[model samples]
Target: MNILAIDTANNFLSLALHKDQSTHIICEDIGNKQSEFILPKINQLLTENDTKLQDLTSISYNAGPGGFTGLRIGLSVAMSLAYSLKIPLYPVNMFAMYHNALNTETNSIIALDAKLGQIYLAGFDNNGDYLIEPQLINPEQLSSVLSKHNLINDDDTIITGNGWTAYTEIFNQDISSQNIQYIESNYPSAATMINLVLSGKSQPCAAHEAELLYLRNKVALNLEEQKQSKQ
Candidate 1:
């Protein structure tokens, strides 16, 4: 099966083509100008691979809990591609993509800077199974939320994503555990997107069902709701 994967849900704009048992990620571009270059980059990838849009068996993308505009752009592209090509679209989370990016298993948390001093967060066990449902929360509330839900692990916890860079001090102070491993190099990639495309894990959905996975219903309203819920 041939699958095309995309991830523009963050600063990174990447595209991958998965064929045979090996993954061929033609390009993984990182920049702030996703809106300007995403489709052109995709076209370049297909042209380089000597493939056509209709040749893909599936389309996979990072559906987000990240940037509002980036998420909308990526999901729109994925849905449009799937609709035009008559292929299934899998809206995988950036955390799931991060999980598959891992070369080895370990208790890990994936966070994406959700702006306004909060992040989109999720966890995975050593087996890469989801330990906590994905949500948007502030760095100040992260530790307490984990404790309230009994999701804290004494084992070394690996943390990755743009959030780590943005809220380093807050996370460090809140986590408290001495065994935290922070990875600063990697970002979500179309290569990780291919993991789902190749696994055949996504179900075909109607065009209407294909939508952005905004962890928070209304990004602008979340801060008010969080404050009200706390009060």
Candidate 2:
């Protein structure tokens, strides 16, 4: 079955198409420009691969804990495409995609930028079970938060996500894991969703049933809060 996947939960727009048992992936570091590039990139991906939009049997998207506007754009695009194409829709979690992509043996933590001096994090055990659900926390409070969850207290715990990528200096100073590791793969890709699809981990549903997975209620901050957050 041919499938198309989209991930615009962050600045980068990542698209993947699977056909003829081959997977094609495209990732563009277009910050805050997903709306402009998503459709064109999808077209380019399909055209370059000799595939048609109607040929896709299913579509998947990263239903975030990410950028508010990015999630809206990606979700709307995915749902519209799925609805029009009459194909099933798969709503994949951004963090779970990274977890699946890394396949790390030790406990792992996914921390993605939430802006306003906050981050979205999810903790998983070595067996891929959730130790902590996705939630927002300040980077400086990571130690306390992890300690409260008792999720990644071990010596070899792995933490990988764009949160670290975006604030490497902060994490290196605030987080004191001797071997704290952040993977080179900090961004999400539709290819990761394809991996989940192949493993039957990311389930599919009708377009009407697809929904965004938000971790918090505060989407935007007041001007004063924004100014303070930078401090």
Candidate 3:
């Protein structure tokens, strides 16, 4: 399988090219400049590998619960490239990738700092399937939601993604578990996205139908709009 993947959901901006069973990455750029840097990196990778756009069997991208600007950049490039290349665009959930990266004996909770004291969170079972729809909530609400979803008392649980950094203390004190592993090296990356894409498990999205999964719409709204909607 030949695959190309891009991720700009967090501080890490990455691109990966996979041919056969080997992977080549073109990264080390700042995440904030993804829009400006991604295309050049893509061209560079293709050139280095002696490949072309039409050579890609599939293209995948991180569909966010991430930086507003970075998400737009990553998605726009992905949708445009997929459309132009006449290939499918796969939207890989950040949480799913996080779960797949873990070696957990049970469910894995993927969380990202949603800012404003809230987190964008999702849950995945041992087999890397969605256990709950993604949502925006604080630590208490997240715990409550997990309980409501019947995910409590997970004896062998592992929590990952950027959310761990924000809610580690709360999770350590509150969530009951015999084993909890927080792996920092498993940060979100396009390379991980490509792994799922090649495995044929990523959700296929069309150019027009593709949408960024911002957990809270209000965060994207202006202050006046937010106040008006509240009223």
TM-score, one value per model: 0.84, 0.84, 0.86
Which lDDT tens digits does candidate 2 get at residues 1-231? 899999988778999999999999999899999999999999999999999999999999999877779999999999999999999998889888888878788888888887766788998877666887888888888877777866444665788887877778877786656455666774556788998888787889999999988777755444566778779
Any runs in candidate 2 off by more than 4 Å, and if so which? 165-184, 221-231
For residue 165, model 3's alpha carbon misses the true position, in angstroms, by 2.2
Model 2 has an lDDT value of 0.84
Question: Candidate 1 on 1-231: residue-level lDDT in tens?
Answer: 777877777677778887666666655545678888889888888887888887888887777766677777878888888888778777777788777777556777788787877888888887667787788888888787677656566455677888878998988797857456777647656777776555654455655588766676775586787788888
> In model 3, which range of ten residues has the least summed lDDT?
176-185
Candidate 2 lands at a TM-score of: 0.84
TM-score of 1: 0.84
The per-residue C-alpha lDDT of model 1 at residue 207 equals 50
Superposed Cα deviation of residue 84, candidate 1 (Å): 1.9
